[model samples]
Target: MDHNDLSARELAARIRRGELRASTVIRDTLDRIARVNPQINAIVQDCGADAMAEAEALDRRIADGQQVGVLAGVPVTTKVVSDQKGYATTNGTRLFQDVIAPQDNPFLRHMRQKDAIVVGRTNTPAFSYRWFTTNAMHGETKNPHNPALTAGGSSGGAAAAAATGLGHIAHGTDIAGSIRYPAYACGIHGLRPTSGRVPQFNHSGPDRGIGPQIMAVSGPLARRVDDLRLGLEAMAGYAPDDPWTAPVPLIGPTFRRRVALVKRPGGIDTDPRILDDLDRAAALFRAAGWEVEEPTELPDLREAVQLQIDLWLSDGHEAKLAQAEQEGDAGAIALLRHYADRAAAIDVARFGEIFARRSALIRAWRGFLEDYPVVLMPVSGELPFQQDEDLRGGDVLTRLWEVQLPQIAIPLLALPGLSVASGVVDGIPSGVQLVAPPWREDICLEAGELLERGFGFPALLPR
Candidate 1:
């Protein structure tokens, strides 16, 4: 059987039924990665030996009448920035390449506890600060569908891996659009759960500063939405190490089936093709017996986006800029400089301003969600841009972030957002973004399933 073609759900079910040995599935997954990874540069660090050993161990355990995990025999890749025991949490830079992790982070620990084999570690941008993925360490990851366009940054490798069947599910992190944009760029689905949904901690480094503590989170990327659900359930287990997360259940109570559809988020000059994608998604919801409406305006997304950029500067950009300069990666330097300029200044009062505004914005957005439980919008203002588009600087960088407004704004609200592939558009892959109330990832997934069926995207896109 082509194990690479099976969704995590289907593969795990088959394995749990003793239809396939864990070792066989893992060997096939490694073979798939060896054949496809070079073209996309997705999985930066291969764990083939470790994977085989674990797979064999799992097989032995099953034969000995051990309990089966929900993700038995499933293959997944964690982002390089995340801790996976004995691997370097490179985070796309060589500065800390020697800083090997002694223990797995909360998410990785949880995945292993559920018998999900880690086949490799995916790439990320140098500082994981940009929407385009490229770095001096792991090199650039290309879009598997069209190398000319971006594979999506930070979590680009994760998305590319999912798109090309390198792994059944790809683990990703989202502070901005790291998870969603890559999924959109590579024609896959990525879920950015609520801030506290999945435990977040990296013992290999100092604890996260203010900005990341609040917005940054771990999530799942997969070719199938059901695989995403499996990945999430495996990852969302409680880790006492991370104070942000709790013992929350994956399923949440149902809310009204009403959705608000916005053509342009944060007043972006959305492309006509993107507008068409939104219409297509809306039609799917309507077909699913859900109410879809186009509101005159929602909360001030533009302002929230600005605040997100500001939050990134909580520690100030000087040190970050210096690090990027040291790394000397063109893309990292360019992005760090680009956004740092926007957030540069001297102000102790900025912290006060940030929180007060954050509170007010949260209230506004949460109240808005009270009326519309879900919001369907474009993943970006335009289709995935040409690879290294942001490196062009000036108008290109400006335009890139303008369309990324939806992605950059969502994190500030601390809600669950899902990116569901809408199939390739005009030779470039594009998709729709779904937002639900905090801790209500189930709602987004429910709606994503309807959109997924309507779009008819296969579990894996053609590479």
Candidate 2:
């Protein structure tokens, strides 16, 4: 079998058993990226020499019989928004094109500590906004399944790269379906670890505002459920620099393998195909002995989604507009105009009210979560839409928000969401998401595993 096509679990096993060397694996990965990335536009920046050197070091450690960490030699991509020492943390903006970091973000440091090789950086929308990955600086990232459709953003590059086997696991950040939606779009799996489950700190940038500090989180997008678990284990921890960082157990005793089926969180209708996939996923879980219940109603998800916009728009509007203006990119300017009017009236008091209500909502969600281990829901209201189709007018923004309702809502609860590819719907990839209580990603993975098995493990793109 081609080493590049192996799951992270299989590749790691081979590397540890000395059946393959890290250098060989990385070389194959680079070659795969070269062949497939052009079509997908998934990997935006290459860190070739750095990746090779890291792999060689891992090979040497293996030869010396040293203790190698779990992901030793696995090739991975970092999202542009995350900081990696000595690399430009572009954050998908020309404004920060020269922004270099002297130290790694906590997640990157942790990945390196686990001996994972940094292969490249993935793309995002400008300022990591929007549900599609496109920017004047990095360009659009096409879906591996169908180039016509969107590869959901802001982690679209990561999801595309992972789907195409450019890397076994791609690092991603989630603020509103940035992680899970992309995974669904690209026909793969993504995990949005509960806020602070993963230690995160960026030494190169100013402290983010409360909105981002609460809603944004770093996570992983990968080809398999096991890889997601491995990636989360390597990244989750407590960092003194991120005050919200929490120490969560990497593994805990198994809980009741029960999941709540939320056909549409907040009564919003889901695409028939997406609804079918969710039903199929639920049946798969049932066959696996997991009790699945169709919860009559979900939490006040619409309220949570709206509050997310309020928090994000409060103080972020001017900052985002100024950054876009600085970039002077047509696409950025267009997006700024789309959001500017909606955010025009936000004030300090309104922002504070949103924050206060957010806390209350989180508390309420936590209480509801205590009853259900996992909530299986649609990753998006529909599958990946035509790329740039939404750019046609103002109504598209509402459509984008409607389709991305779940992504926006989950973050407000400060919980984790996992998108597992169930199967393809009419040649386009379709997936279901599993939402777990804050800090309990195990439930998400448990549900993800069942879905993967039922789906028959679809092949990597363009093999």
Candidate 3:
């Protein structure tokens, strides 16, 4: 059997049933990475020796009649931006390549406790500041389906690695669209759980600013909806280190399976293919006994997206821009400068007011979500951008941001957003976004499963 083709949950079930050895799965995973990683540069740091040892130890424990965790024997990759004891949490920057983490982030520790083997560390853009993944430190991650298209930044390496079978699951952190966009671009599944649903803490780095503290979250990217569900189950929990971690149940109460389909939130001009994919996804949900609503009233997505960027840049935009300049990442520099230039006029009082008004926006969104448990929207206005499309010019960046309204807006509302790969359009992968109210990831996953079944999950690999 091709072990590499099996989902993480399936592989773990096989390992637990004694049909496959953990070591064998790990070795196969390592071999797959060795063969494919060079082409995509998804995994920036390989952990073959440690992974092999852990797998062999797991095998011994199983033979001794010990009970392993749910993710037993599954190989996974963690984004380099997170703390993973013994590896440098470089955040894809040359300035901190030597900043070795003294301890694992709470989420990584949780994954380890669940017996998920860390096979490698995936790459990210420098400081993880852009929508395109490239840096002077770890280089760029390419789309598995097409090299000319972006892999989707920040978590691009994780999405690419999962898409190509280098890992059964890839750990990713999202503040904006870091996790979801990559999944859409790479033809995989990524979940940006509601803030605080998954515990997170990076001891190796400085404390995060207010924006990230409230919006950023760590979740999983995988090839199947079932794997995403399993991964979230394993990662969800409270950590003493992360004050933001909420003690919420992974499973929430059942909701009426009604969906609100917003083809273009905020009147942004979306590519025809993106709208087609959304229509196709809505049809699938409707056929599967779901009540689909169109022309639904949604909150101001443009305001939310702009507020998110303002919050993200409010604390220290100039400092970040200067750092990006020093790092020599043209993309990051341009993005920061663009934001700084646009936000230059906002005084401190206005910034405070904008942050204070976030609660009102959340309240409005929650009320809308009360009637429709799931909201299906375009993951991006356009399909995956050509590699480095953000660097082309200011007009391109504006267009990119406009289409990414859904992605940026969800984080501000602290809602769970799921990116499900519907199918391939033309030569590129296309998909839709599923969002639910806070702590209601179950709703998104349930709807995602129906879409997966109706549209069928496509196994994407780089040519």
Q: Could you estimate the TM-score for every candidate?
A: 0.97, 0.96, 0.98
Cα lDDT computed for each candidate against the true fold: 0.87, 0.84, 0.89
Best first by TM-score, ranked: 3, 1, 2
lDDT of 1 by residue, 314-412 (tens): 365788889889988887677677766565663669778988999999999999999999999888898888888888976787788787899999898
Kindly list the per-residue Cα lDDT of model 3 for residues 1-463, writing each as its tens digit: 7776677788998898888999999998899898899999999998999999999999998888899999999999999999998899999999889989999999888888899999999999999977778888999898888889999988999999999988888999899999999999998889999999999988998888888999999999998998999899888899999999988888888788888989888998878988888888888877888899885467777888878988887568878888888888898888888777666776789777887778889998999999988999999888888999888899989888888998999999999999999887666998999999899888888888888987787675743
For model 2, residues 341-374, the per-residue Cα lDDT tens digits are 7688887787788878888888988877887888
Q: Which ranges in model 3 have alpha carbons more than 4 Å from their true place?
A: 460-463
Output the lDDT of residue 404, model 2: 79
- Alpha carbon lDDT of residue 299, candidate 1? 89
In candidate 1, stretches whose alpha carbon ends up further than 4 angstroms from where it belongs are 459-463
Q: What lDDT score goes with residue 123 in model 3?
A: 91
Q: Give candidate 2's TM-score.
A: 0.96
* Clashes by residue pair, model 1: none
C-alpha lDDT of candidate 1 relative to the true structure: 0.87
